[model samples]
Target: MSTGQGRLIIVVTVCVAMLLAILPMPDWARPFRPPWVTLVLIYWAIALPHRVGVGSGFVAGIVLDVLTGALLGQHALAMSVVVFIAIQLHQRIRVFPFWQQSLGILVLLIVEHLFGLWITGATRGTAPALQYWAGPFIGALLWPWTFVTLRKVRRHFKVT
Candidate 1:
Protein backbone atom coordinates (compact mmCIF):
# COMPACT_ATOMS: atom_id res chain seq x y z
CA MET A 1 0.00 0.00 0.00
CA SER A 2 0.99 3.58 -0.47
CA THR A 3 2.39 5.39 2.53
CA GLY A 4 -0.73 7.48 2.93
CA GLN A 5 -2.96 4.42 2.66
CA GLY A 6 -1.04 2.55 5.31
CA ARG A 7 -1.17 5.50 7.65
CA LEU A 8 -4.85 5.93 6.97
CA ILE A 9 -5.61 2.33 7.80
CA ILE A 10 -3.78 2.58 11.10
CA VAL A 11 -5.51 5.81 12.01
CA VAL A 12 -8.90 4.42 11.07
CA THR A 13 -8.37 1.34 13.18
CA VAL A 14 -7.28 3.39 16.16
CA CYS A 15 -10.27 5.65 15.81
CA VAL A 16 -12.58 2.67 15.66
CA ALA A 17 -10.98 1.30 18.78
CA MET A 18 -11.47 4.63 20.54
CA LEU A 19 -15.10 4.61 19.51
CA LEU A 20 -15.52 1.15 20.94
CA ALA A 21 -13.88 2.26 24.16
CA ILE A 22 -16.42 4.98 24.69
CA LEU A 23 -19.52 3.17 23.47
CA PRO A 24 -22.24 2.93 26.12
CA MET A 25 -23.15 -0.35 27.76
CA PRO A 26 -25.54 -1.53 30.43
CA ASP A 27 -24.46 -0.92 34.03
CA TRP A 28 -23.66 -4.58 34.65
CA ALA A 29 -21.68 -4.86 31.41
CA ARG A 30 -19.76 -1.63 31.80
CA PRO A 31 -16.91 -3.05 33.79
CA PHE A 32 -16.56 -5.94 31.38
CA ARG A 33 -15.94 -3.66 28.43
CA PRO A 34 -12.54 -4.53 27.05
CA PRO A 35 -9.89 -1.89 26.82
CA TRP A 36 -10.20 -1.53 23.07
CA VAL A 37 -7.77 1.35 22.63
CA THR A 38 -5.10 -0.39 24.67
CA LEU A 39 -5.52 -3.62 22.69
CA VAL A 40 -5.29 -1.85 19.35
CA LEU A 41 -2.26 0.15 20.43
CA ILE A 42 -0.57 -3.00 21.64
CA TYR A 43 -1.23 -4.70 18.31
CA TRP A 44 0.19 -1.88 16.23
CA ALA A 45 3.15 -1.38 18.52
CA ILE A 46 4.07 -5.04 18.17
CA ALA A 47 3.25 -5.35 14.47
CA LEU A 48 4.92 -2.11 13.35
CA PRO A 49 7.04 -0.83 16.17
CA HIS A 50 8.89 1.54 13.90
CA ARG A 51 5.70 3.15 12.70
CA VAL A 52 3.77 3.10 15.97
CA GLY A 53 5.53 3.47 19.27
CA VAL A 54 5.26 5.60 22.37
CA GLY A 55 4.41 8.77 20.49
CA SER A 56 1.54 7.13 18.68
CA GLY A 57 0.30 5.72 21.96
CA PHE A 58 0.46 9.14 23.62
CA VAL A 59 -1.44 10.80 20.82
CA ALA A 60 -4.10 8.09 20.70
CA GLY A 61 -4.40 8.13 24.47
CA ILE A 62 -4.74 11.90 24.54
CA VAL A 63 -7.59 11.64 22.08
CA LEU A 64 -9.15 8.92 24.18
CA ASP A 65 -8.78 11.03 27.31
CA VAL A 66 -10.61 13.86 25.66
CA LEU A 67 -13.30 11.57 24.31
CA THR A 68 -13.81 9.85 27.61
CA GLY A 69 -13.49 12.96 29.79
CA ALA A 70 -10.63 11.48 31.70
CA LEU A 71 -7.89 13.33 33.55
CA LEU A 72 -5.90 15.08 30.81
CA GLY A 73 -2.78 12.94 30.69
CA GLN A 74 -3.98 9.84 32.49
CA HIS A 75 -4.51 7.63 29.50
CA ALA A 76 -1.66 9.24 27.63
CA LEU A 77 0.84 8.30 30.32
CA ALA A 78 -0.54 4.78 30.71
CA MET A 79 -0.66 4.15 26.98
CA SER A 80 2.83 5.49 26.35
CA VAL A 81 4.20 3.12 28.94
CA VAL A 82 2.25 0.20 27.49
CA VAL A 83 3.38 0.93 23.94
CA PHE A 84 6.98 1.39 25.04
CA ILE A 85 6.94 -2.05 26.64
CA ALA A 86 5.24 -3.57 23.62
CA ILE A 87 7.83 -2.11 21.25
CA GLN A 88 10.69 -3.29 23.42
CA LEU A 89 9.32 -6.84 23.45
CA HIS A 90 7.85 -6.88 19.97
CA GLN A 91 10.20 -9.52 18.66
CA ARG A 92 9.63 -11.98 21.44
CA ILE A 93 5.92 -11.29 21.47
CA ARG A 94 5.69 -11.86 17.73
CA VAL A 95 7.16 -15.34 18.06
CA PHE A 96 4.81 -16.43 20.81
CA PRO A 97 1.90 -18.79 20.11
CA PHE A 98 -1.61 -17.34 20.41
CA TRP A 99 -2.10 -18.49 24.00
CA GLN A 100 1.25 -17.17 25.06
CA GLN A 101 0.61 -13.94 23.21
CA SER A 102 -2.61 -13.55 25.13
CA LEU A 103 -0.73 -13.99 28.39
CA GLY A 104 1.69 -11.30 27.35
CA ILE A 105 -1.19 -9.03 26.42
CA LEU A 106 -2.72 -9.66 29.83
CA VAL A 107 0.43 -8.39 31.49
CA LEU A 108 0.44 -5.28 29.36
CA LEU A 109 -3.22 -4.62 30.06
CA ILE A 110 -2.67 -5.06 33.78
CA VAL A 111 0.16 -2.56 33.64
CA GLU A 112 -1.99 -0.08 31.81
CA HIS A 113 -4.73 -0.43 34.39
CA LEU A 114 -2.26 -0.08 37.21
CA PHE A 115 -1.05 3.20 35.83
CA GLY A 116 -4.59 4.44 35.53
CA LEU A 117 -5.37 3.28 39.03
CA TRP A 118 -2.31 5.00 40.42
CA ILE A 119 -3.20 8.25 38.74
CA THR A 120 -6.78 8.05 39.91
CA GLY A 121 -5.79 7.36 43.48
CA ALA A 122 -3.23 10.12 43.52
CA THR A 123 -5.47 12.72 41.98
CA ARG A 124 -8.87 11.84 43.38
CA GLY A 125 -7.78 10.38 46.73
CA THR A 126 -9.89 7.33 46.04
CA ALA A 127 -9.75 4.17 43.99
CA PRO A 128 -12.38 2.62 41.81
CA ALA A 129 -14.30 -0.46 42.87
CA LEU A 130 -13.38 -4.03 42.14
CA GLN A 131 -15.28 -3.94 38.89
CA TYR A 132 -12.71 -1.54 37.49
CA TRP A 133 -10.25 -4.41 37.46
CA ALA A 134 -12.30 -6.59 35.16
CA GLY A 135 -11.47 -4.79 31.94
CA PRO A 136 -7.96 -6.13 31.50
CA PHE A 137 -9.04 -9.75 31.93
CA ILE A 138 -11.72 -9.28 29.31
CA GLY A 139 -9.25 -7.63 27.00
CA ALA A 140 -6.84 -10.52 27.48
CA LEU A 141 -9.57 -13.05 26.80
CA LEU A 142 -10.32 -11.35 23.51
CA TRP A 143 -6.70 -10.98 22.41
CA PRO A 144 -6.53 -13.98 20.07
CA TRP A 145 -9.51 -12.85 18.05
CA THR A 146 -8.29 -9.29 18.03
CA PHE A 147 -4.82 -10.28 16.90
CA VAL A 148 -6.16 -12.46 14.12
CA THR A 149 -8.55 -9.82 12.83
CA LEU A 150 -5.95 -7.07 12.88
CA ARG A 151 -3.33 -9.28 11.24
CA LYS A 152 -5.76 -10.05 8.47
CA VAL A 153 -6.45 -6.36 7.97
CA ARG A 154 -2.77 -5.52 7.93
CA ARG A 155 -2.04 -8.23 5.38
CA HIS A 156 -5.03 -7.47 3.19
CA PHE A 157 -4.15 -3.79 3.08
CA LYS A 158 -0.47 -4.49 2.72
CA VAL A 159 0.13 -2.07 5.57
CA THR A 160 3.85 -2.14 5.95
Candidate 2:
Protein backbone atom coordinates (compact mmCIF):
# COMPACT_ATOMS: atom_id res chain seq x y z
CA MET A 1 0.00 0.00 0.00
CA SER A 2 1.04 3.58 -0.49
CA THR A 3 2.17 5.63 2.47
CA GLY A 4 -1.10 7.54 2.66
CA GLN A 5 -3.11 4.34 2.56
CA GLY A 6 -0.96 2.80 5.25
CA ARG A 7 -1.40 5.87 7.41
CA LEU A 8 -5.14 5.71 6.91
CA ILE A 9 -5.22 2.09 7.97
CA ILE A 10 -3.21 2.84 11.08
CA VAL A 11 -5.52 5.67 12.03
CA VAL A 12 -8.61 3.52 11.64
CA THR A 13 -7.05 0.71 13.58
CA VAL A 14 -6.12 2.96 16.45
CA CYS A 15 -9.60 4.48 16.51
CA VAL A 16 -11.29 1.11 16.67
CA ALA A 17 -8.87 -0.12 19.31
CA MET A 18 -9.46 2.96 21.40
CA LEU A 19 -13.19 2.42 21.19
CA LEU A 20 -12.69 -1.17 22.26
CA ALA A 21 -10.60 -0.16 25.21
CA ILE A 22 -12.96 2.54 26.39
CA LEU A 23 -16.22 0.67 26.03
CA PRO A 24 -17.69 -0.06 29.42
CA MET A 25 -17.24 -3.58 30.65
CA PRO A 26 -18.44 -5.53 33.65
CA ASP A 27 -16.79 -4.45 36.88
CA TRP A 28 -14.87 -7.70 37.20
CA ALA A 29 -13.54 -7.58 33.64
CA ARG A 30 -12.92 -3.88 33.78
CA PRO A 31 -9.96 -4.27 36.09
CA PHE A 32 -8.40 -6.70 33.70
CA ARG A 33 -8.77 -4.41 30.74
CA PRO A 34 -5.88 -4.65 28.33
CA PRO A 35 -4.36 -1.37 27.32
CA TRP A 36 -5.47 -1.88 23.75
CA VAL A 37 -5.06 1.74 22.82
CA THR A 38 -1.67 1.89 24.43
CA LEU A 39 -0.53 -1.25 22.69
CA VAL A 40 -1.51 0.08 19.28
CA LEU A 41 0.08 3.42 20.08
CA ILE A 42 3.32 1.74 21.03
CA TYR A 43 3.27 -0.44 17.96
CA TRP A 44 2.91 2.48 15.63
CA ALA A 45 5.34 4.58 17.57
CA ILE A 46 7.99 1.92 17.12
CA ALA A 47 7.09 1.02 13.57
CA LEU A 48 6.61 4.53 12.20
CA PRO A 49 8.25 7.02 14.48
CA HIS A 50 8.50 9.71 11.85
CA ARG A 51 4.78 9.53 11.08
CA VAL A 52 3.55 8.88 14.60
CA GLY A 53 5.44 11.10 16.98
CA VAL A 54 5.00 12.49 20.47
CA GLY A 55 2.36 14.84 19.13
CA SER A 56 0.29 11.92 18.01
CA GLY A 57 0.71 10.36 21.42
CA PHE A 58 -0.35 13.58 23.07
CA VAL A 59 -3.43 13.88 20.94
CA ALA A 60 -4.41 10.26 21.48
CA GLY A 61 -3.87 10.68 25.19
CA ILE A 62 -6.13 13.69 25.23
CA VAL A 63 -8.82 11.71 23.46
CA LEU A 64 -8.41 8.91 25.97
CA ASP A 65 -8.50 11.40 28.81
CA VAL A 66 -11.85 12.65 27.59
CA LEU A 67 -13.17 9.17 27.06
CA THR A 68 -12.05 7.71 30.40
CA GLY A 69 -13.17 10.72 32.40
CA ALA A 70 -9.87 11.00 34.25
CA LEU A 71 -7.97 14.21 34.74
CA LEU A 72 -7.63 15.83 31.34
CA GLY A 73 -3.92 15.41 30.79
CA GLN A 74 -3.21 12.23 32.71
CA HIS A 75 -3.29 9.74 29.87
CA ALA A 76 -1.66 12.26 27.58
CA LEU A 77 1.38 12.56 29.80
CA ALA A 78 1.69 8.82 30.25
CA MET A 79 1.30 8.15 26.54
CA SER A 80 3.83 10.87 25.80
CA VAL A 81 6.34 9.06 27.96
CA VAL A 82 5.64 5.75 26.27
CA VAL A 83 5.94 7.23 22.79
CA PHE A 84 9.18 9.01 23.67
CA ILE A 85 10.72 5.83 24.94
CA ALA A 86 9.39 3.82 22.04
CA ILE A 87 10.87 6.29 19.58
CA GLN A 88 14.23 6.05 21.29
CA LEU A 89 14.22 2.26 21.37
CA HIS A 90 12.41 1.49 18.12
CA GLN A 91 15.49 0.18 16.38
CA ARG A 92 16.20 -2.34 19.13
CA ILE A 93 12.61 -3.26 19.83
CA ARG A 94 11.87 -4.05 16.21
CA VAL A 95 14.66 -6.67 16.15
CA PHE A 96 13.91 -8.34 19.49
CA PRO A 97 12.08 -11.62 19.65
CA PHE A 98 8.34 -11.36 20.27
CA TRP A 99 8.62 -12.47 23.87
CA GLN A 100 11.37 -10.01 24.67
CA GLN A 101 9.47 -7.23 22.98
CA SER A 102 6.41 -8.07 25.08
CA LEU A 103 8.50 -7.70 28.20
CA GLY A 104 9.56 -4.26 27.10
CA ILE A 105 5.93 -3.43 26.45
CA LEU A 106 5.13 -4.59 29.95
CA VAL A 107 7.65 -2.18 31.39
CA LEU A 108 6.22 0.63 29.34
CA LEU A 109 2.71 -0.17 30.54
CA ILE A 110 3.93 -0.15 34.14
CA VAL A 111 5.40 3.29 33.67
CA GLU A 112 2.17 4.51 32.11
CA HIS A 113 0.20 3.19 35.06
CA LEU A 114 2.52 4.91 37.51
CA PHE A 115 2.01 8.17 35.72
CA GLY A 116 -1.71 7.61 35.82
CA LEU A 117 -1.56 7.08 39.56
CA TRP A 118 0.45 10.22 40.06
CA ILE A 119 -1.97 12.24 37.99
CA THR A 120 -5.00 10.82 39.75
CA GLY A 121 -3.46 11.70 43.09
CA ALA A 122 -2.95 15.24 41.92
CA THR A 123 -6.37 15.79 40.37
CA ARG A 124 -8.75 13.56 42.31
CA GLY A 125 -7.52 14.34 45.81
CA THR A 126 -7.42 10.68 46.75
CA ALA A 127 -5.16 7.71 46.44
CA PRO A 128 -5.65 5.59 43.39
CA ALA A 129 -7.54 2.34 43.82
CA LEU A 130 -5.73 -0.97 43.74
CA GLN A 131 -7.67 -1.68 40.59
CA TYR A 132 -5.85 1.13 38.90
CA TRP A 133 -2.51 -0.70 38.91
CA ALA A 134 -4.26 -3.81 37.72
CA GLY A 135 -4.47 -2.16 34.32
CA PRO A 136 -0.78 -2.49 33.57
CA PHE A 137 -0.42 -5.87 35.22
CA ILE A 138 -3.14 -7.32 33.09
CA GLY A 139 -1.95 -5.33 30.13
CA ALA A 140 1.39 -7.14 30.46
CA LEU A 141 -0.36 -10.46 30.53
CA LEU A 142 -2.20 -9.65 27.31
CA TRP A 143 0.83 -8.38 25.42
CA PRO A 144 1.65 -11.56 23.57
CA TRP A 145 -1.84 -11.95 22.18
CA THR A 146 -2.03 -8.31 21.28
CA PHE A 147 1.32 -8.36 19.54
CA VAL A 148 0.46 -11.43 17.56
CA THR A 149 -2.93 -10.17 16.49
CA LEU A 150 -1.69 -6.73 15.54
CA ARG A 151 1.20 -8.26 13.65
CA LYS A 152 -1.19 -10.38 11.68
CA VAL A 153 -3.30 -7.38 10.86
CA ARG A 154 -0.30 -5.43 9.71
CA ARG A 155 0.93 -8.26 7.57
CA HIS A 156 -2.45 -9.06 6.11
CA PHE A 157 -3.32 -5.49 5.33
CA LYS A 158 0.17 -4.29 4.51
CA VAL A 159 -0.23 -1.55 7.09
CA THR A 160 3.46 -1.00 7.58
Candidate 3:
Protein backbone atom coordinates (compact mmCIF):
# COMPACT_ATOMS: atom_id res chain seq x y z
CA MET A 1 0.00 0.00 0.00
CA SER A 2 1.00 3.56 -0.42
CA THR A 3 2.15 5.37 2.68
CA GLY A 4 -1.18 7.17 2.99
CA GLN A 5 -3.12 3.96 2.58
CA GLY A 6 -1.06 2.18 5.18
CA ARG A 7 -1.61 5.02 7.58
CA LEU A 8 -5.33 4.87 6.93
CA ILE A 9 -5.39 1.19 7.70
CA ILE A 10 -3.67 1.78 11.00
CA VAL A 11 -6.16 4.45 11.92
CA VAL A 12 -9.08 2.22 11.00
CA THR A 13 -7.74 -0.69 13.04
CA VAL A 14 -7.20 1.52 16.06
CA CYS A 15 -10.66 3.00 15.68
CA VAL A 16 -12.22 -0.43 15.58
CA ALA A 17 -10.29 -1.37 18.70
CA MET A 18 -11.51 1.77 20.38
CA LEU A 19 -15.07 0.85 19.51
CA LEU A 20 -14.61 -2.63 20.92
CA ALA A 21 -13.20 -1.23 24.11
CA ILE A 22 -16.39 0.70 24.78
CA LEU A 23 -18.88 -1.90 23.66
CA PRO A 24 -20.82 -3.03 26.68
CA MET A 25 -20.61 -6.50 28.17
CA PRO A 26 -22.77 -8.38 30.65
CA ASP A 27 -21.94 -7.98 34.33
CA TRP A 28 -20.89 -11.59 34.72
CA ALA A 29 -18.91 -11.42 31.52
CA ARG A 30 -17.29 -8.10 32.32
CA PRO A 31 -14.52 -9.73 34.30
CA PHE A 32 -13.77 -11.94 31.33
CA ARG A 33 -13.62 -9.06 28.90
CA PRO A 34 -10.40 -9.19 26.99
CA PRO A 35 -8.46 -5.98 26.69
CA TRP A 36 -9.37 -5.56 23.05
CA VAL A 37 -7.59 -2.27 22.54
CA THR A 38 -4.42 -3.52 24.15
CA LEU A 39 -4.53 -6.72 22.13
CA VAL A 40 -4.86 -4.76 18.89
CA LEU A 41 -2.08 -2.42 19.95
CA ILE A 42 0.18 -5.37 20.71
CA TYR A 43 -0.54 -6.99 17.34
CA TRP A 44 0.22 -3.83 15.43
CA ALA A 45 3.27 -3.10 17.53
CA ILE A 46 4.64 -6.53 16.79
CA ALA A 47 3.64 -6.77 13.14
CA LEU A 48 4.34 -3.19 12.09
CA PRO A 49 6.81 -1.87 14.58
CA HIS A 50 8.01 0.92 12.34
CA ARG A 51 4.53 2.21 11.65
CA VAL A 52 2.93 1.49 15.02
CA GLY A 53 5.10 1.94 18.04
CA VAL A 54 4.87 3.82 21.32
CA GLY A 55 3.30 6.92 19.80
CA SER A 56 0.49 4.91 18.30
CA GLY A 57 -0.04 3.09 21.57
CA PHE A 58 -0.03 6.25 23.62
CA VAL A 59 -2.55 7.92 21.34
CA ALA A 60 -4.81 4.89 21.27
CA GLY A 61 -4.56 4.58 25.04
CA ILE A 62 -5.42 8.23 25.57
CA VAL A 63 -8.45 7.75 23.41
CA LEU A 64 -9.30 4.73 25.53
CA ASP A 65 -9.00 6.79 28.67
CA VAL A 66 -11.46 9.30 27.28
CA LEU A 67 -13.88 6.69 26.01
CA THR A 68 -13.86 4.79 29.27
CA GLY A 69 -13.71 7.85 31.51
CA ALA A 70 -10.59 6.41 33.06
CA LEU A 71 -7.83 8.32 34.81
CA LEU A 72 -6.42 10.75 32.29
CA GLY A 73 -3.20 8.91 31.48
CA GLN A 74 -3.70 5.55 33.12
CA HIS A 75 -4.21 3.49 29.98
CA ALA A 76 -1.87 5.75 28.09
CA LEU A 77 0.99 5.02 30.44
CA ALA A 78 0.26 1.30 30.61
CA MET A 79 -0.14 0.98 26.88
CA SER A 80 3.00 2.95 26.19
CA VAL A 81 4.94 0.54 28.37
CA VAL A 82 3.29 -2.55 26.86
CA VAL A 83 3.81 -1.43 23.30
CA PHE A 84 7.40 -0.52 24.04
CA ILE A 85 8.03 -4.08 25.12
CA ALA A 86 6.21 -5.46 22.10
CA ILE A 87 8.19 -3.29 19.76
CA GLN A 88 11.45 -4.25 21.44
CA LEU A 89 10.76 -7.98 21.09
CA HIS A 90 8.70 -7.83 17.93
CA GLN A 91 11.29 -9.42 15.71
CA ARG A 92 12.09 -12.28 18.04
CA ILE A 93 8.50 -12.94 19.08
CA ARG A 94 7.25 -12.87 15.49
CA VAL A 95 9.36 -15.95 14.80
CA PHE A 96 7.77 -17.92 17.62
CA PRO A 97 4.93 -20.39 17.20
CA PHE A 98 1.33 -19.48 18.01
CA TRP A 99 1.46 -20.89 21.50
CA GLN A 100 4.57 -18.97 22.33
CA GLN A 101 3.10 -15.81 20.88
CA SER A 102 0.03 -16.31 23.00
CA LEU A 103 2.19 -16.75 26.06
CA GLY A 104 3.89 -13.49 25.27
CA ILE A 105 0.53 -11.82 24.84
CA LEU A 106 -0.54 -13.09 28.23
CA VAL A 107 2.53 -11.65 29.83
CA LEU A 108 1.98 -8.30 28.15
CA LEU A 109 -1.64 -8.19 29.29
CA ILE A 110 -0.56 -9.00 32.82
CA VAL A 111 1.93 -6.18 32.72
CA GLU A 112 -0.73 -3.75 31.54
CA HIS A 113 -3.07 -4.92 34.28
CA LEU A 114 -0.40 -4.57 36.92
CA PHE A 115 0.34 -1.05 35.83
CA GLY A 116 -3.35 -0.24 36.01
CA LEU A 117 -3.65 -1.77 39.46
CA TRP A 118 -0.65 0.10 40.74
CA ILE A 119 -1.91 3.44 39.45
CA THR A 120 -5.37 2.83 40.80
CA GLY A 121 -4.01 1.79 44.17
CA ALA A 122 -1.77 4.80 44.37
CA THR A 123 -4.85 6.94 43.90
CA ARG A 124 -6.79 4.90 46.50
CA GLY A 125 -8.39 1.54 45.73
CA THR A 126 -8.46 -1.93 47.20
CA ALA A 127 -6.77 -4.88 45.59
CA PRO A 128 -8.98 -6.24 42.87
CA ALA A 129 -10.20 -9.79 43.08
CA LEU A 130 -8.69 -12.77 41.30
CA GLN A 131 -11.40 -12.39 38.65
CA TYR A 132 -9.95 -9.00 37.88
CA TRP A 133 -7.05 -10.90 36.37
CA ALA A 134 -9.24 -12.98 34.09
CA GLY A 135 -8.87 -10.51 31.27
CA PRO A 136 -5.31 -11.59 30.55
CA PHE A 137 -6.25 -15.25 30.43
CA ILE A 138 -9.16 -14.58 28.13
CA GLY A 139 -7.08 -12.32 25.96
CA ALA A 140 -4.30 -14.89 25.75
CA LEU A 141 -6.81 -17.55 24.77
CA LEU A 142 -8.01 -15.34 21.95
CA TRP A 143 -4.54 -14.50 20.69
CA PRO A 144 -4.28 -17.11 17.94
CA TRP A 145 -7.54 -16.17 16.29
CA THR A 146 -6.93 -12.47 16.79
CA PHE A 147 -3.50 -12.82 15.25
CA VAL A 148 -4.73 -14.70 12.21
CA THR A 149 -7.67 -12.36 11.62
CA LEU A 150 -5.63 -9.19 12.01
CA ARG A 151 -2.84 -10.56 9.83
CA LYS A 152 -5.36 -11.27 7.13
CA VAL A 153 -6.88 -7.82 7.44
CA ARG A 154 -3.50 -6.13 7.27
CA ARG A 155 -2.51 -8.20 4.27
CA HIS A 156 -5.79 -7.51 2.50
CA PHE A 157 -5.34 -3.84 3.08
CA LYS A 158 -1.76 -4.09 1.90
CA VAL A 159 -0.77 -2.29 5.05
CA THR A 160 2.98 -1.84 5.28
Best by TM-score: 1
For candidate 1, lDDT tens digit of each residue in 1-160? 6989999999999999988988889988998899999999999999999899899999998999999999999999999999999999999999999989999999999999999999999999999999998999999999999999999999999999
In what order do the candidates fall by lDDT, top score first? 1, 3, 2
> 43-75, model 2: which lDDT tens digit per residue?
888877888899989999999989988778888
TM-score for candidate 3: 0.97
* lDDT minimum window of 10 residues, candidate 3: 121-130
For candidate 3, lDDT tens digit of each residue in 86-143? 9999999999999999999999999999998998888867777789899999999999
Segments in model 2 whose C-alpha atoms lie over 4 Å from true places? none
Query: For each candidate, what TM-score against the reference?
Result: 0.98, 0.91, 0.97
Candidate 2 backbone clash number? 0
Instruction: Write the number of the candidate with greater TM-score, choosing between 1 and 3.
Output: 1
**Candidate of highest lDDT:** 1
